[model samples]
Target: MTPVTYATALYRNLLRLNGLGYLFRNVSIGMTDHGDVRNRGFLLKIKCDSVTVLRNVRQKFKTLNLKDKSVARIFCRTLHGSTQNEHNNNIHDIDYITFTNCDNDTCKILRNELLLLPNFVSEEEEKQVVLEVEPYLKRLRYESSHWDDAIHQYRETEKLKWSEKNAIIIQRIRDVAFPQGVKQISFVHVLDLKKEGFIKPHVDAVKFCGNTVAGLSLLSSSVMRFVNTDNKAQFFDVLLERRSLYIMKDTARYKYTHEILKDEESVFKGKHIPRDRRIAVICRNEP
Candidate 1:
């Protein structure tokens, strides 16, 4: 890494390290009463690259605090590149990452970048449900409230979790994304793609009261192309390393359109990456 790169990484590392022991001193009252999630403007830049590996730091919550309704935190980890077989049937091979159990050392709770199966159904069950649920995806429109029919809502946690395995996968996603349990995080996950490939030049209208961050959990190596809308040829590419987390927020979200290349192979970091049947878990949260 060059001196400039090292300096940028140090700046980001310091931002996080300061968060470790620093307490909010001001008695602020607006959206973020504690000023935990800050809202800065566009053109924000972060320097985490393709591959990253991390362990859920074992945090001992004070005796379950039955009085405490809930707590939530998200750690950005593992963005390094790894080769994946395009023919590998194991869907797990596509994404590489895990989640922390918030509390640890009880029963084994397998972590994942997306589906952290917590006392839930098996992964095979999840596959079957996604198969059935996918057909309804064609009906997923911008006008609707969520992914379900006229009878039910896709955002309902309890009702859907009991039956549909897709719902279970979705529930785990919600747990990590919107653990706060009120209002929705408002996200979208596109699994099936055009025969050639997929992604659109689009910007989601965000109505978050706090600093909203978009987490892209890539299950396979795919090229997410971000271009300066103002200058079409002035583009950037991100090789979403499998099982790692990619975040887009602030100015990046508003200024660039993240598009997935359709062709089987795309270039990143001076290396070529091939695409596969990919699944991405888009995660976020709110009050």
Candidate 2:
């Protein structure tokens, strides 16, 4: 049998073993075999609505002991594209605050200080921002090693200049989030997180930045968890959707430690939040 045919058979058998044979009706699988047998490669694509089933399939794939044993890249696409716009519109009008058994006082404090605004920028503006800063990010190496042990598997750069259009967007964020008398930091920070990257729980150094830090989410969605510093039991999760803006100020910035959870641990409202590549544009106030 040809290599493509063999791969198709192998995939089907594995799915059946995992009790996911029913996915065959919803999933479309195709393969492209390179010319040489020894150097041949193939691509597998699966489309399904269930994140739980996708996680199970991924776990099963990880059990495969191939000759190379290299990691397989999985890309997820939402089936409902038309509802995305409506979803953005709805989130834009609402403020989402979730707490885990925290006291009413603490929850009220967080609710007042933490703000998440979805669809803060249009799709075209997000694209423009990415296009402007991607070249700088590409030049920098991924910061896997750090002295402070704060971040993991990310690339970051500070940009002082922005295009005229981008500058207007930045100013809007500043006017909305930060107070007028405070001195804004001169440069904007661009951070790119890998698919498997995460930010450990830590507060921003007081000496480096002031009470307010505003960030614009791009590319992917993620969950930012806030843990009370004095009492670890008091914590909450904020869902940061793409094209959304999050502002942490006063109590939310100083009283709590914030971190971006890894994909495996990224669950909000009992649903798994799969993270691909995420880019955040962060702006801060001078200390």
Candidate 3:
């Protein structure tokens, strides 16, 4: 049989399985040659909402008969929440913060002393910064051993030096995002997230970092959500576009718990915003 026909048959078989019809409807199936003329393979990519669903699907998938069993593979991924619909139901009461411009006064609607600067750096400048920091990023691991339990599926490093041109860029960021009189830390923190990585809601440790936290987003866009620690129903989602910078201080920094949602749960203004590998250059003042 042709590859397409085989793939269709496999998809049909999965859909016909009892108790999993709803899940099979969302499964993505395809066939690939892996750029090799001799080898052909069938790939089944399953996105499940919970670990229980994934376990059930895997056990069922194993029971299916395959013409070429050696070449058939099933890959299952469980996102933080299974589907966008599930996420919407949970966040129906949360508020969203839209970006108008870089003006601090206009962006303060979300919280006091919170600001987002869109396109903080030009494309060329972003490339230069990425090139300068690429060495530090290379050493990152898929899972970071941070003391905080809130971070997951992330790689992070701290650097104290930069090239002359990159140093100027950092200084420019400090001038724009940070308070002038405050003593900023010399080292910069780099946090890289895998496509499926996410940050759970948590406040930054006051002992390790100070009142202000500024970050420059790179590689991909994501929604940074802030929820009031005292009020669970009160929250805001801030879209952090690529190359944009965000600063949080005072009430926004201390009174709100911040988190980065997983790709499946990343929605802003009622639209799904798919996420990919993301890197951020973070700067903070002395504690």
Candidate 4:
């Protein structure tokens, strides 16, 4: 490594050592990968009893250099309920929270009530249902093909057809998820995204719908990102598991922009999962 790089790494290690015992009177040092400084390096946070000790550590950290080091290795570990907990709480300012284990029987019932279509259909039943609803699906408008270079396709309709199974499920989701309850279903959209197709960041149009929105994932798993519109630097990513149901209310619905990213796969909770042809059913409340 270059001299400059070596010095930088040493400084970080010194700060960590200070966090362990030396400089701060009574504080814990928490490390994070989300530091604004250094862009790619870990950030060391010193939570201490006195502001004076904190000040001293920062000043001392500036002048230090590695005197005896030929090579440097940095060891990192997350403090349980520290950094991860704070991150979860920050993004969930709204009533929005991700339900990862939607396949469970209990969660399946909740999904039926709140976000997804109840009673999963068999493959034969699905083919019949598609045939029955093919007319409306064709009539629905296609989203901008330029957005995905024609790789992904989508069609949506605001009007409900009683013959379609999704129409009934949308009403059920609205009834059980809304507090004041839905006066009417405002809009429902179905997205057909290829492995390479994804949406960019944009908040939903408030004039078209109310404050609550529910979505159902079908066919594949992908990552959805939420960015705080008021604070562009603040953002979070949630994994949308196949057959999963997710809801956005309060700040998440009105104050943040949501998107499906362009990557073909994502790593969540340490497992690498690939994206496939994904179909999402999005329902909005009546304005």
Candidate 5:
């Protein structure tokens, strides 16, 4: 639980950026120190001991025409078809679609999660992973050859904790998941491969502010392909390079389907590059 130092009566209004909603109770409208964070106390009562407020917020969100489907449609068109560094032959997919790469004329509503997960990796563990993770990833490549067309994951439920570094990341992710008094949580370390070493077109089922967020910490070299499910599945690839952190939210998580290519032998400008094992830590939140 976070020690809230906020006060109520400072909230101006509420807004939705990427389909996730927040309880923006007042905190900065020149309120008094009330001996503690008023916003936290207010949120404590508003979100309450149950998820009723959460459900209500979601229902009202649908009426505003800000549902996931509507957001996903706009997400697809904003891409204007593909990104830079994407290969013509590599198929791709995305779980969360963002308007990060849109034209200047577009609106930019960067939703600020009052609950921002500031730190990703712990200090000592960060050093440890930096030193040893590469070797493990090297081993993983050969090991991956034995598995095909599957997703591998770990737990973030109330059952166990990962390495100390992972445990730290897990806790922060947990804050995002059970921001309210949630019931259950499940975390995983997942990797979806290209059956032939490349993925076909597909959509992801990771939800944020609702179910799960694929908190990806890239450990190897790979590309994620994004395509519009309603269209011809025309695509683009995103490079999940070494040590990158990606957070796919909202419609991007469920709409605008995506996949990792499984192309092992193909004509990519008449060149051939063997596919390597791709590894990701897939943490989940369930309630």
Candidate 6:
């Protein structure tokens, strides 16, 4: 779980207990006034007798704010139950999908594993693949019905037969990246994009595809935002770099709808990354 998630969950539980008269209410976050640096970490001094509750709260605090420098040292103190707790409103309720960034340690570990490899293709390989796929871009038709006229030309290939090198890459992905019980994936959908091309938020039809979908991003970097179509408040963004591989399974695939903005950039970790002409080779197992 991310720091934001841990903090949000702890805040939720505290609110629940406060409602039941179990917790001293008005929770406030502030810094310490201690003299020495040794005794200077933020304190959560709640007047409570429940040892389990205290332990859980401290653990959550440690995970949520200790590592990230941008987060504040929140000292939660409970006041009378009648007091309105403004501190509780710090985090928005987020539950549409699970996300992990490329910078995360867990994601780094997983990238080395079989299930989710990030930069599976080399830069040279990406260039070659782009060259091979460029010829089919001419066959693309303008999709005026779905998107704005300025940003909607795309070519979705019919069932494709891979070349010798492409077939080898697929075999390797299957052997290492795919989990057991997954059927073989035979075809790929190559979507060629125009300069300002983008697709709006939508989920793939489960009737035609499997639970797991693997995509290889080539030629450009872009930001794809996954939004909860129902709530609209809960959403997450992921940066898709050239030569990277991404996997969407279970909740990420079925619950959240993904979209890319036309003529836009995504801000991630305080850096603004621009979008470019991207080719997404989407591979899905038969359901």
User: Which candidate should be chosen as best, given lDDT against the real structure?
Assistant: 2
In angstroms, the error of model 1 at 180 is 4.0
Top candidate, metric TM-score: 2
After the best TM-score superposition of candidate 1, give how far the Cα of residue 265 lies from its true spot, in angstroms. Answer: 5.7
Pairs of colliding residues, candidate 2 = none
- Model 1: number of clashes? 12
Model 3: clashing residue pairs? 49-82
Per-residue accuracy of model 3 over 1-287 as CA lDDT, tens digit each: 35544444334333322224355555655555443222322344445555565554444333322213322221110011122223243422223354322233323323235555566666777899888877767875689534677878888888788887678667756654453356888899988888889999999988888888989999899999888787766677887888877878777888889999999999888898889989899999889
* Cα RMSD (angstroms) for every candidate in the order listed: 16.4, 18.0, 19.7, 20.1, 12.6, 15.1
Residue runs of model 2 more than 4 Å from their true location after superposition: 1-95
Q: Which stretches of candidate 3 lie over 4 Å from their true place?
A: 1-111
Off by over 4 Å in 6: 1-116, 145-151
What is the TM-score of candidate 1? 0.41
List the candidate 4 regions with Cα displacement exceeding 4 Å.
1-153, 164-167
lDDT of 2 by residue, 155-209 (tens): 9888888898788778756754564356989898888998888899999999989
| Candidate 6 all-Cα RMSD | 15.1
lDDT of each: 0.35, 0.67, 0.63, 0.48, 0.35, 0.51
lDDT of 5 by residue, 146-260 (tens): 2333332211112254576455544544443332344444635444343345554555433433443545444344445555455543433354434334444444445545555
TM-score, every prediction = 0.41, 0.66, 0.62, 0.50, 0.43, 0.56
Q: What lDDT tens digits, residue by residue, belong to model 6 across residues 1-287? A: 33333333334333332232235343433333333222322334333456655555444433332222212211111111112333332211211113432223322222221122345565666776766777776666745444333236555674466676666555544433344346855777777665577877788877878766777777777777766556666666666666666666665677667776564555654566676777888778787
Q: How well is each residue in 27-116 modelled by candidate 1, as lDDT tens digits?
A: 111211221212211111332221120111111111111111112111222111111221332232223221112122111111111122
Model 6 TM = 0.56
